[model samples]
Target: MADVDQVRPRQAASPSMTARQRLALGLLLSAGFTLAVDFSILNVALPGIGADVGLPLDGLQWVATAFALCAAGFTLLFGRLADMFGRRRLFLAGMALLGVASAAGGLATSPAALVGARAAQGLATAAVTPAALALLTTSFPEGPHRDRALGLNGALMAAGFTAGAILGGVLTDLLSWRWAFFVNVPVAAAVVAIAPAVLAPDRLGRRPRLDVPGAVTVTAGLLAVVYGLTAAGDTSWGDPRTVAALAAGGVLLAAFWVIESQVAAPLVPVTVLRRPGVRWGNVAGLTAFATETSLVFLLTLYLQKVLGYSPLVAGLSFTVLGAGTVLGGIAGPKVIGRIGGRSAMVAGFAVQAAATLTLVRLGPEPSWTALLLVATFAGGVANLVAIVGFMVTATSGLPDREQGLATGLATMSQQVGITMGIPIMSAVVTARVHGLGGQGPGAVLGGITTAIVVNAAVCAAMAIVAAVFPRREALTQVPPAAPPGT
Candidate 1:
């Protein structure tokens, strides 16, 4: 039986970055920017897309939410592909798909076309995210070298999300909303051209073909889960479609586990989840991500619907959250070192929890300056603390050879949170605001607040799990959430 050990340690001298490793990381970072930016930027253009395509307000939610769903659903499958095929080839192809999809989306004449294109774009994103990360992990040798590369990769992602808002806002304001999608064309082209030279070959062996049946079952199951959550908000709890979807999702997922358990190279190694640090890390990530994603979705609505801010302003408002994330990403290492990952996770959660509960009690009529200030500074802080802390935990204990898979799994979990969180929050908002006439805004705000509160509580729980990490000793020497880029 071929274990992961068949692959030898590949290394570079001096900076310890294999030239290809450096090149791969660079291309991957570039590829990653589009995903981060799309999250904050698209909402800025959502109204424009809706207005042009004639989508109902509720239907517009699908534009953003569906992207997350499709992206999350395909990540694991794609991640496995990168492992079985070639990571570099898959990454570049994924970039090409993204570019094509974005172009189609931008040129769409109808909502259905746009949504279809966006889903394609999401699938492309899923492929790139995992493939790129896995490529980087394999390209870089283990130990401090891998850690540094991972840290930088984390920072770039943090920076990209923040930078995305700034660029998205500027572009949407200066040109048509189409420019947001258009912007990717040049970047994607650049990455596609550069990626091949730097990236490593895929870790492929002439193994049996992937389990198509199992893959399909898992994908359908996940799609159903995403669908159910999205539909649940607009429909009754007993809605037949929703119940059926959820049930199907559960059954299919169970089947997936059975299939994987018997397979040679499983998509998710069951043994992996048994590790305390990895388990808690993922738990923390999901909850924290749900909170943050829900916050952005709700914040965009509040800024646009309630505050009457244009798409540009709403996007600009998000810059603050991005900024905070950057700060936290940069600071996370130090914070973890100082307080320990566990303490940092707990303290960070406390900080975010305080911010969210406060938002709940505050009246809706608050001034723009006040709202912007809170959303910008507090959001940033909460985001940085939560994400970095969670990531540290996620990366803690897996064997070096499996780091790429671990990274892929962690990244996939983050996407899943985004997928699951948005719909849940959106549904909560829709339900709470269902009957409200003049108080519609308040009801929506309350629902959002509830989601945030839930997020804070979940983070607090993650802290408990983080407390027991094996790296508790080193975690103390570092601190979390300083700034992302710097």
Candidate 2:
């Protein structure tokens, strides 16, 4: 196997995006949007799905967990496959699989069938996300153009989640819960059809051998960890299932590390982790996702349980937060260009910390105009700004060959953060609520306040970490574009 860290020639800066590049970007962004939409679109429709399929509450929960677990577990493995085989090939296959899985999910009549379809969807997503992102980073030269593209990508993804939430409710009411799953079918088909014509062809290269042991161990470990975390949400951390899963995961991961160090062609080169950009960028991304997702959960609870808002009303209230994120995505690239990614990241985190702190002021009385909207909106903006910065930072200065690995690592951090955040905060809030007597508005508010305070402290600490760490050079700078026609 060829060494992944071999130095390559750097390309001179390109002037602007060609028409083909633009089309390819559109297809990539569509894939991202579809994936993000799928994640949240089922949230409001879960009850309806459970009813139609005769699923119990626990079975209904698996509808979401199956997707998250598979996606988180297989992302790194698929990412490495993309790098070794072909990113474009992997991307097209993923899209096709997603379409097929979505169709199956929509047609399902039983709980097992629907859950199986969801797991397939998650696997497809794991393949598509890293491959699409890797294609983007490689195709777009790392600079203003790439930054702009990433900003739009971030914005659309955030918008997709928000749109899914509202659209899921509407579709479930107007038609059926199945419509939420059916929606992605057409989108995926369109991308698959158009992508071949528009996107650049994958370059033919020597096929590097896979690190089978590393692949098996890491995938198993991640699945175990994600399963344990998900289980912790429903039961206590001390539950036997959770404890066993976590312990197994820890052992597997440790074994994976040992195997990677001894292997000649490791799945992930240790040097990649040594790079300050990749290391701190992932840290920032994980922190940002964890805190922001927790904030959303807390706010949702506050809006419904405390303020007595209808689910629809609470969902609508978040439209402002979505709007704020879009605006931040539009501005994030420009801000990074002006101040650099590290500085932009630190600033975004600092602002996010402040915004989260302000949420502690929320109370039993509705504060839509005064505190709630402003804080949520600010939190959304800061969150995206931080997210965009993290992506730019992580992908920067890496050669095109390793883009898949870099993106996979970054995306895995995001999935893990999103998976873990709600559970951790739930545990905290449960403890605090019980301490203060129990489930009343005042107790819930106090519990939420405690969680928000912890979230704010985490943001603040990460900001300091980003600021204090000196940026290190990548293993190798991004290589120049391949000569035309090989």
Over 236-313, each residue of candidate 1 has an lDDT whose tens digit, in order, gives 557898899889999999998888778876666777766555676677777767776676676777776766677667
Stretches of model 2 off by over 4 angstroms after superposition: 1-15, 368-370, 470-486
In model 2, the worst 10-residue window by lDDT is 1-10
Q: Worst ten-residue run, lDDT, model 1? A: 1-10
Q: Report the error of model 2 at residue 228, Å.
A: 1.1
Provide the overall lDDT of each model, using Cα atoms, as 2-decimal numbers. 0.68, 0.85
Estimate the lDDT of model 1.
0.68
Measured by lDDT, the strongest candidate is 2
Q: How far off is model 2, as Cα RMSD? A: 5.6
Error of 1 at 224 (Å): 1.0
